[model samples]
Target: MSAAGPILEVEAIQAFYGTIQALKGVTLQVNQGEIVTLIGANGAGKSTTLRTINGLMHPKAGKIRFEGQDITTTPPHQIVAMGISQSPEGRKLFPRMSVTENLEMGAFQRKDKENFKDDTERVFEYFPRLYERRTQKAGTMSGGEQQMCAIGRALMARPKLLMLDEPSMGLAPVFIEKIFEIVVQINKDGTPVLLVEQNALMALDVANRGYVLETGRVALEGPAAELKVNDRVRKTYLGEG
Candidate 1:
């Protein structure tokens, strides 16, 4: 947790889906207690970057380090155990499972089962709606509720770094605002977050720093407040001229 060092680092990583390269020497870092966001258009390799860090897809080149340890080739489960968890895009919930059950699945790798209840309760504190439907099937819930469950499930893993991929996708404006508020609250509670969001304005509003990705490379990066006013960023991403 040194002030000069990052908690997670991605160094010039290159990734591919089959033969098509999706990430081109992408590099970024998340310092301890910071919300660092990656904002980009569709197919800009934002999701690929998260998948690479979480070990769902290993990069053919470059490196990933978490807490100064190499996890470039670690398995997904091992990555989770190492304290990096991702609430993936698409809110991939266990459709038939109860909301509570889906949350428990996040803690499946925990060695200490005794604190499970406390962890679940903590998620309820963040999203009270989750507690109200704890016994309901995941698929029966609304999109925003399902997104809450997805984030709650990731938190159940008690990660040191939480990577959220498009948490605001498919939600109404009210729910979207609430989700971003919770994300900021989570960061305040001490978990560093690497958020990939299409809502550029909202993402920049909540993030401490941000990187703009395009095609497969980083186009711009700086403190979020600065980027929000940068002429290029405002015209391209923020829909301003």
Candidate 2:
């Protein structure tokens, strides 16, 4: 699962919406089959970075590469075919759709329909509560259940690289623990993760590497364990001396 080259690379990307700039010359990389995190405060442009990579947001300048192929200009749906999938900041489920229906949307680009069905069952294995509520409308579920559905939906795509934005946001402490544990399990099962999170402590614990973001750019980056013990990280993020 080792990436001979970076599975995803952002080279000096300057992303914007008209005159309003969100990311200023940001750059980072995610190695194959590894969990790499981007940690920052709100409005630090972390979510924008993930959106650009997934093609939800376009880059006004710079390059993005996946599996050594340039994908900076690829459309969102096509990007999915190339094996990158995102579970965005908001769970974004179809409120009127049943949990099963919402999951089916994730595999829309897939050619092997039968395998996609099997994959859905696998998603249930990981989040068994989803199976119990499969026929229920998505909007009726709790925050933690919705988060599980979002992640499970992304897995339906069988992506090579998964991008997750704030998977633990708004959950209770116990649910947050369950969510992080599921993230580690997903990574162990062979899909690389590019995680953008507010929960720096848990993110660093599960990740192989981490990048600290300030404003719209990478401020610091290193092995997760090293970052965890850094004085700056402790004082600012870990809330310690």
Candidate 3:
């Protein structure tokens, strides 16, 4: 983790899905260059938390501060401009578009278009497969390849904080390992990440700190190392006795 202060702070935020609440007073923080993960089971509101932070869902109450500014109700595009980018749960790539085109969309908001090639090269360096399939349609690619493109797209944004939702979901074990390795490399290259994942063991392995959410509320919070060895965490999330 970098010495810089918290880049994002979610304070007791409550979010609802048309009156059926999804996030119950959730609070968490991601400091500069730190890999902070939110781990939970299905329907645990982990995705909701990320959506709220990204301004896709407005909080019913509480505040979200990014880089020390209040943005609880900011528009999603505006939030993206503020250096927060999300590679959402489904990868959400443009199925008909070529890999290069999909990457171009990620940098659509940048005024510095001249450096787009350089940025794309950097992403290719992270996932050589993307380079190999630069002209292929995104939807036609294998799952692992698509996943790499999704992450590569997010990197094109050059965000200060990257929020990933279930990045390792549905990939083979080898691809899962590869995805995590890229995550580590991304962090080492100076971008902080707020990861949401169902794979608790893998998330904890790469995260500097983690929060466990159960049924729309935070159930446990601690350093990643501590959580990995925690009796309750080990027994419940890790499937360890």
Task: Give me the candidate number with maximum TM-score.
Answer: 3
Candidates in order have lDDT scores of: 0.95, 0.91, 0.94
TM-scores of the models, in the order given: 0.98, 0.96, 0.98
Off by over 4 Å in 3: none
Q: Superposing all C-alpha atoms, what RMSD in Å does each candidate have to the true structure?
A: 1.3, 1.3, 0.8
Task: After superposing candidate 2 on the true structure, give the runs of residues whose Cα lies further than 4 Å from its correct spot.
Answer: 1-4
Determine which window of 10 residues in candidate 2 has minimal summed lDDT: 1-10
Candidate 3 to native Cα RMSD, angstroms:
0.8
* lDDT tens readout by residue for model 3, 1-241: 6547899999999999997999999999999979999998899999999999999999999999999999999999999989999898989999999999999999999888999999999999999999999999999998889999999999888899999999999999999999999999999999999999989999999999999999899999989999999999999899997
Full ranking by TM-score = 3, 1, 2
lDDT of 2 at 190: 88
Which portions of model 1 show Cα errors greater than 4 Å?
A: 1-4
lDDT of 1 by residue, 46-83 (tens): 99999999999999999999999999999999999989
Q: Report the alpha-carbon TM-score of model 3 versus the true structure.
A: 0.98
| TM-score head-to-head 1 vs 3, winner | 3
Summarize candidate 2's per-residue lDDT along 136-234 as a digit string, tens digits: 999999999999999999999999999999999999989889888988889889889999999899999999999998888889999999999999999
Clashing pairs in 1: none
**What's the CA error at residue 224 for candidate 2, in Å?**
0.6
